[model samples]
Target chain A: MERTTIDLWVGVFVAMGIAALLFLALKVGNIGGFEAGSVYTTHANFDNIGGLKAKAPVKSAGVLVGRVTEIRFDNDSYQAEAILSLSSQ
Target chain B: MGVSTRFFFLLLLHSGTCFRRPQLILREIFSSGVLSLIIILVSGLFVGMVLGMQGYETLQTYGSEEALGVLVSLSLVRELGPVVAALLFASRAGSAITAEIGLMKATEQLAAMEMMAVDPLARVVAPRFWGGVISMPLLAAMFSAMGIFGGYLVGVVLIGVDEGSFWSQMQAAVDIREDILNGVIKSTVFGIAVTVIALFEGYDAPPTAEGVSRATTRTVVTSSLAILMLDFVLTAFMFRGV
Candidate 1:
């Protein structure tokens, strides 16, 4: 019974450790790249969207400034227009 | 065929028969899949954290810290995620498999199975082979996801890169198909290579504890080397058109 209890604690500790690690990792890595506040909009037209998805980032000079808030076809130009929201730095 | 040619042919046939049993291979692959997933998730987080820190530091030097998203995404998706996960798997699970089978051989369990009219090849080898095949891509995906998360945490929260800018940069700079596919393809090949080498070494182990230990070490070392070599080959092929 004692050994089983110890084992249970060990499992709990491991689970907590993994969770903590994941939290820290996600906090530090910024993998999802979601941010709050600071919204400015811009547009871009692309011939092929390919795998581009909504909420994808908008980059200028190799730096990320905003995310794509909306995407639609510009019938006049026959191009995909991406509306991006830039953050205030 | 001449006598020499016949002898060579026999050797080839035996070698082929020893390793290429699909059912046995599949079983091994299934087991490897579970093991590989755990390793990949853990390693992916670390890989992402490291990439974020290093990329941030470098970008800061040039007053371009906001490029962290692009750097982390590209590096994780294209290169670091799969390779680091593969290395971790090679060190952890690859060594374990080699040692387990090596010990079995040393204890004559393999011979016992043969004596009992059981095919050790079918029973022992197949599961691990298939396990590796199934596990590798799953592991790679976990690694990629964790890595991206790690970068997000550091780049946005710690450095205060404005959440909007950080994500936007990542989306604009990263070509999802290119980055994600690179990792998947590399991981699949790495899984096969690790499985084959570990299984081969385990089965070929000498009948002693010392021999088993040596085989385990060799499996780890060789699998790591194989991953690196194959990474280069795969990268070359992947980028040839680009």
Candidate 2:
């Protein structure tokens, strides 16, 4: 019984550690954010994404006011087209 | 043949032997899972704390202590966290695996398994190989994230950087795709390398207790060296175009 309780506590601590890690990743990665008043959408083309994923943050002038919503290859140019949603300035 | 060709030949032979037994290897991994988790968690916390302190001090001189968030997060997520976690895991787990297997071999357990038609590679090695593959990335992620938080605590709560600006700088500096992928890829490779080296040393150990001890020591040293070498190669290749 005591062993079981210790195991339970250990499990809880491990879970907390994992949760804290996930939170940090999300915070640093800027996964989800939606501001209240206004938002706009824009697109950019790049020759290579270099492992960029959907929902990766889009930065302009060093602030993360938006995130990438969609990514597709341009048929003609064969480049990545990223659709970004930005909060109004 | 050239020296490189001979080295390549030996590597191929080693890999072939390592892949022989899957199920037995997996069973060993399952048994050792809890111990591995504990080691990872403890080491990760220390790595994060040290990284935060160092990063904060460096950024202070430039009057960009706020950028410590960026520096810590970027460095940990991309490189240091994974490498350090892997090295720790290799030292702790790799040496243990080598010694355990070497002792079994010295005691003729391996020979018994072979005589009974049980493939030792499948039973003894493959599980460990896969365990390292799975565990290293998870551990790396944990280490990197914890390190970032440590930086946040030091940079914001202790050092007086505004919370908002610190977070912003961190968010700005991180290219999620590049950073995360770099860590995951390096750890995966490091895991495989560590497991292979440990298993190799164990299987090749001389037939005595002294031999097992020597093999354990070699496993730790070789795996640690391999982790650093692989980190450099992966960094150069992954970041070349970035």
Candidate 3:
């Protein structure tokens, strides 16, 4: 009886640990940036994006609408080009 | 010096053989791990609550209170979760392991086992070592989970940070492979270091009551220092690109 009880508690402990890993992978990490459907890519030219980097969230009125997929400099136009991928949502 | 070196080698040798008995390892895991788990869970909760409160106040100043979840979860998952849990493990479980083994040594139980041709290192120390190593990562994970829940309680339920934004922002910001996995790796390294130090100190302690107490104290102190030192090195390596 005692052995089974201990086993039960240990099993719960291990389950909780696995649950935390799952949370990390799914919620916090979001794993491979999984999104439903497809994302729409839009290009915009900017004078300077400052410290903006790829994968930065694109927010509209304090709501996250999309992500910056890529950033590059257009030397001919002397402007920064940012590629944004907006979720279908 | 020669005797101590030989003893170290014996510990290394028996560590391999100790896994043969699953029952004994399970018993040691119960004795050495459960208390640490309880302590770490409570600590993690409180830490997260405090973080939620503090983050809300600070971010609210900048009109960014919705980011509380990101702040709390990222902090706990990336750094505080593994590091603080390991420290708690060192103080609670690590000290206990040292004291238990040290007491056994002081009472000449180890000597008796040796005289009977039983390898004390294998029978006594190795199981405890493995028990601790197995426990640390699990304990750290539980700590981070409870911490995230605590943050949710404080930020969403209490302070009224937009529940959706808190979780969604956190999910968007944190990376599993980069942050969480690295945290696990950190805790695992700390587990090995803390347990190895605890077992070594206990096994090498002078067979006296005072000696046992000193060894227990050494286990806590050395484990804390090692955890912090190793955290820095691991962080530098893991976050090198970022």
Candidate 4:
């Protein structure tokens, strides 16, 4: 094959590969959160957290408000605490 | 093993020259990565379809079939994309490289290049090595992307699963760093391991027809085994906390 033909094809292949990575990142992986959105954090204490975990969806009245950033045992309060990162939107 | 290690470092020492002749590397990439795209994409689609079907079968038992997206994406991005793509790359590009080099040696082309004051290591071997390395991770990424599309086709479009839940649940569960980054890291590691093994086996083969055939076989077997072993080690390190 001509060298230019080879170069053109190689360029296409590399471009396709990059496009695939982008698709994985933006579309499939959904890494777009919190990039432009401003967020605020708040704390809530519960006697039992049940199965609530970090990054769990925080729903208010059946709508997603934000996510749980951290779930920990409160040494002082003798209860479980959840740090919620709520989006301004 | 000792001889192969020496060959590997020598290839690395000569790697700089491959960049100087950009066409050499480009040609190798064309032959390795571009040619292999069809198989990677087709195989990815089939694998994803199977995952969707199986995922639906199991999840429908609990009436939780919407999580099919999560299952397919996680499995492909986390494991199958890197592992299966690497295996296909090894068999397709890796073996081709080894066989080509072995044939050149058998035909004394490498020696002729040396006679003409050309460093075959620089002019020939390095480009192929770097080419495989560059091609591998890209191929894996394409594999993962195609697999996801395939799963969407089968799971949502055909099977009547809730499209919104499919994507939203996958997005919620699959993190950029935790799932996707770890996968990219895995494929890059596989790329290096596969390229090095393929190059070494070819360069070390005896200059004879039978030897060349044996070298090609060894390239496939060794690189496949190396990929699997390295996958285990990498998964332990990358996904331990998950």
Pick the DockQ winner. 4
Is 3 or 4 the stronger prediction by TM-score?
4
Please state the CAPRI-style docking class of candidate 3.
Answer: acceptable
Q: Residue by residue across A1-89, what tens digits does model 4's lDDT show?
A: 88778888899899999999998888877566654589999999999888776777788897777888898889999999999989888
TM-score of chain B of each: 0.83, 0.86, 0.94, 0.97
- Give a tens-digit lDDT track for model 4, residues B1-242: 78877888998998888787788888889988999999999999999888888999999999999899999999999999999999999999999988998999989999999999999999988998888889999999999999998899999999999999999889878877878889999999998888888888888899998998999999999999999999999988885452
Off by over 4 Å in 3: A32-89, B1-12
Model 1, stretches more than 4 Å misplaced?
A1-89, B1-39, B240-242
Please give, for residues B1-242, the per-residue lDDT of candidate 2 as tens digits.
16433433454444454456444334444433345667666666676667668877877788877787788888888888789888887887788888888998999998999999976765565556665665666667777777776777767777677888788878756765677666777877887788778878887899799999999999889889989988888888887562
lDDT of each: 0.70, 0.72, 0.84, 0.89
Model 3 C-alpha lDDT per residue in residues B95-209, reported as the tens digit of each score = 9888988898889899999999998888898888788888888888889988998999999999898988898888877766777888899999999888888888888889888
Off by over 4 Å in 4: A46-53, A71-73, A78-80
Q: Is candidate 1 or candidate 3 better by DockQ?
A: 3
Error of 2 at B75 (Å): 1.1
Q: Please give the lDDT score at residue B65 for candidate 3.
A: 91
Scored against the true structure, residue B147 in model 2 reaches a CA lDDT of 72
RMSD (CA, angstroms), candidate 1: 9.2
The global Cα lDDT (0 to 1) of model 1 is 0.70
Best of the candidates, TM-score: 4
Task: Give the lowest summed-lDDT range of ten residues in model 3 chain B.
Answer: B1-10
